[model samples]
Target chain A: MKCNRTDIDTETRLELEGALDALTAPEIRPIFDKVVTDGRKRVTVDIHKVTMIDSSGIGAIVSLFKRIKAEGGQVLVIGARDQPLAVFKLLKLDRVFGL
Target chain B: MNAETKPSDAGEPTVTHVTFRLRASLAHRSLAIGLVSTLVEHVKSADRDFRNAITTAFGEAFNNVVIHGYRNRTDGMLDVEAELGSDHMTLRLIDDGVQADLSSVTPPDLSTLPEGGLGIFMIHALVDEVVYDSGTRNVLSLTKRT
Candidate 1:
């Protein structure tokens, strides 16, 4: 996954591309964690270009959500489609994220 | 190609299957998906939802074999056979690896938004049925209705 950071006054948006699975999940886990730890006020994750996502990818996002929410910030997941969207809907993360 | 199709002259639905053995490694996960995708694609009449389910569920099942059953061991054996039926798909997965302790593998509580324990849960939810047998060899039979 490729993460492009956009820092704004209210949020930090990471435009991620490629497949998020067991192979790529590890590479992004630390980066996501650091983004939260660095006090990113609001997180917007764009998964529009993500082709496939497995449990590992979902785990990284959930972990990121937990940390950011605990730190009094919110996470906004945008533009999820296809397999990734189905996964989010099945797991009911869509409701959690209010997507 | 193990995906031999039996065509019937009497208007019977043709049954076809393709089999491949995979090294139980994460590196082979994409190959597993690609193999199943080809099989799913062969069924041209199936709708988008059905194809998507088979693709996602098969990926989850293959991941379990490699990550949970084999525990990332490259030497572990996982044999995947996928069949394209007229209205559904069947995947027979045989793995020579450590047996999964099924008793502990239960559905995750969705209220908690747990991450790690959701793989098996998602697999069960996405597929029509999941049958697991453990003995001399571990077998996971997954069926998804198209």
Candidate 2:
């Protein structure tokens, strides 16, 4: 999986493309860390390009959310497809994350 | 059915059991229709509850396979193994493109609006059991009762 970044006003947007499965998640972690270190309070992850997701990919995303929230920041997710959206809703994360 | 057909001859023809593999890109709007129709026909039964359960469980699993496993690889194949049984159904998913790190993938925090990481959580929540084995091959096994 490849993650590209763009700065749009106050939101730091992440564009994830390809498989975000277990093996590829680590490739995106550094970007998440850099975003947090930049002191960005509001983050938006755009997954319109992201195709597949697995448990590990989900875990990495959760870790990013927690790490960001610990600093009193907010996280937003955009454009989740079939399986990932169902996962978020089933875990009651739709309400938690307001996706 | 002949138990042993290993007559190793050039024209004897070795028969390998044919396994059906279906591939499609299903939109979110057709989630219920796609899942129910596909799974029921594959399993060859019309039990409402069984269909419901299979649809519910496999729906989440397939979603993950497509969206997460193959990363919605518009060109990816959702390799499925559907072993029909009298009491239960077993599905094994194999995808060469998506390699999941079974150890590190965890459920997102339930208390927050997670920007990500809920696929596995839902798969675990809806199915009787979900297992992931990763290596040269990435495999996901899901089971549901009739």
TM-score of chain A of each: 0.96, 0.89
Top candidate by DockQ: 1
lDDT of 2: 0.62
- For model 1, residues B9-122, the per-residue Cα lDDT tens digits are 587888787788868788878788878877887775777677677778777777777787877577887888877877778888898788884323577788798878777777
Q: Which DockQ value does candidate 2 get?
A: 0.13
Residues A1-83, candidate 2, lDDT per residue (tens digit)? Answer: 78888988878888898767545777888899899999888898888677555555677777888888899898888888665
Question: In terms of lDDT, which candidate is strongest?
Answer: 1
Candidate 2 chain B, poorest ten consecutive residues by summed lDDT: B13-22
Off by over 4 Å in 1: B9-11, B101-105
Question: Model 2 residue B17 lDDT?
Answer: 19
Q: Candidate 2 — which residues are off by over 4 angstroms?
A: B1-81, B84-88, B92-109, B112-124, B128-141
Alpha-carbon DockQ of candidate 1: 0.83
What TM-score would chain B receive for each of the candidates shown?
0.87, 0.60
Model 1 residue B141 distance off true place after TM-score fit, in angstroms: 0.8
